[model samples]
Target: MVAPDERIGPAQTGALRLRLSLFYAGFFAFLGVQQPFWPVWLASHGLGATEIGVILALSIGIKMFSAPLAAHGADRSGQRRRSILVLVAGSLAAFCLFALTNGFWPILLISVLFYALWPPVMSLTESLTIMAVQRASLDYGRTRLWGSTSFIVVALLSGQVLVWLPPSAILWLSLACVAATAAACLFLPDIRTERSPLHRGLPIVQALRIRALSLSLAACGLIQGSHAVYYAFGTLHWQAKGYSENVIGVLWAEGVLAEIVLFAYGGRVTRHLGSVGLITLAGIAAVVRWLGTGLTDSLAAVVVLQALHAFSFGAAHLGAMACIGETVPASLSATAQSLYSGLVWGAGLGLMLLASGWLYHGLGGSAYLAMAAVALAGTFVALRLSALTPRLPQP
Candidate 1:
């Protein structure tokens, strides 16, 4: 492994991890509130599944382009932290407009503003976290676990809170989390890009050209993108099935709780299996998980399936991050991170959302069948990834 630390001293490396961890915790707390319950809030507006799908799809699609552009700037200027601060502030301001509108189109417009600004920040932050990991010999999973912790907390608590409050409260609570994220971003390292000739010579397209890198991104896209229906309609579907909001929240928490433990322990496990091996496991588990989710409304069955989040999401993500960290050099770090985020979460999720709307309406619980198919395809891609020769680092 190449340990490129951007010339920071050993002492600063430890603090950098803590700062990055806090940023993850705060940002995911924001996600905790939004991801599970935002649909409920939109439903409160009387938007049907098709409309909500379009709104969510557009949000996902926009990030495909927006994150890369922002990340390119971060990579070029070597100001990842500063760029994130601006994004956080801009997203907060955009969310503020949500309160001023109640109609479908108006809220959708504000979402456009909000999604464009917020989704890109995480890829930029991931670039920072991965760089620190390479230099300091830290674990990406451990640092990322904090975000999962906050996610569970907010999911459980907000579910309880929503029982007493209107769905509208999600906006204010989400704002508070973003504000905290902004505060954390201020503490992050302001490391600049090294003026090395190797770094200077690397172009963004080169990362895409490498067979391993592109395959890794494709495998991740299929695996991670498979969550589209769950992210968009899991709560609504459960609610329609008569599960209480609190139970719905617990269901969401259960999945991420599995993911949290995976992050805590994935370091040694992934080290042995390597990124490609872990991704293969992730794809296989995703197929099983979604297959079960599509087949049953049995709460016990559903809860058990959610446990596969450890493999389906946590393992897949851990492997993908490792792949990006190991394959892409420091010069293209942010750009590569954005590419992963855009393609996997951005385009993949976006396209799935477009389909999930129609599927959920017609097939109900069986909508997850579509996702299972996506995961199955990703498994085949992972097999291809395993066959590629690893690229050696160029200094």
Candidate 2:
């Protein structure tokens, strides 16, 4: 097995793992508040549904191009940590501008700026964490579970907070959390090592030529993008269907709770099922989840379906990370990670969210049927991914 070396003692590795976990936990808790609530806030500020969609889509869309650019700069300079810190500082400024703006154009411009700075953080953090795991030989699952746990906690609590506070409070809370992330970044150890001149630019053509890799990326994108309907309008849909905000919170929390469990046991799971198997299973789960969500209006049914997010999102993501860690060279790790984030989360999700807005407005509850179809396509691609490459021993 091609496993990370365990040369560093457990004591040292354990401490670093704790630090990495804390950083991501705090960071994503901020996102947990933002993603679900930001659009609601925009609507509250008198942006129509179409306008709100445009702003959100624009915010995420720019990441497709910007993330690779950021990764290229980091790789070329061999200053990943410095690059992250600079972007975080830039993100803080963008948020400040957002706070001061009310006009559509200004808000849109700030959103683009904010997202441009935002995309690099996750990719760089993943690169740094993977490097740390390799250096200290720590279990990635154990180290990463804290993030999932934190997200659930913040998401549940923020739901109640929204009931008591104005929607704008979400923005302020997000800013505070980002500030904390910046502080955490200051403490993060600089982990950049030798640079490869050969890995300087985006390997667009080369990566696209890898049939298995390309298929996996495409499948993952579609499967993950299938969440656009739910992510953008799930709460509003439930609200319209007469579910209380608290119940909506519980539904969302259920999904993250499942994700936490998945991350907790991720290492063992990956050890038993290879990355391709995991991703394929996730695609299958997504098909079921989206279909079930579309077919039922029952709160219990929705909650049950949301729990499948463990496989649909958690397992699929772990599988993708494992693939990148195993197949992509260390020098190209940031770029590969960024490509995943940019292509899947940025472009794919952005486009799906836009389509979802139209569908939700036009077809109402049945919009999820489209999401299910998307998941089915992803499932087919995932099955194909298994055949494209030889199975490797699990980590």
Every model's Cα RMSD, please? 3.7, 3.2
lDDT of 2 by residue, 1-395 (tens): 11223245566776778767877887888877877788887876677877887886777778788878887777666667888889989988888776787756777778888888987887888877777756676677777888788777787788878899998898888888888888877766566745646644354444455566677788889999999999878988889889987788778778888988898888788878877888888888998998888789788888889999999998889888777766665666677778888888987888898799799999887898899899889889888888777786553
TM-score of each: 0.87, 0.90
Give residue 248's lDDT in candidate 2 (0 to 100): 80
- Candidate 1 has its poorest 10 consecutive residues by lDDT at 194-203
**Whole-model alpha-carbon lDDT for candidate 1:** 0.82
Displacement of the residue 223 alpha carbon in candidate 2, Å: 0.7
Check candidate 2 and list the clashing pairs: none
TM-score (C-alpha) between model 1 and the true structure: 0.87
For all candidates in order, the CA lDDT equals 0.82, 0.79
**Residue 240 in model 2: lDDT:** 84
lDDT of 1 by residue, 270-358 (tens): 77888888899999999999999888779888889989989999998988888887887676778888888889888876777767878
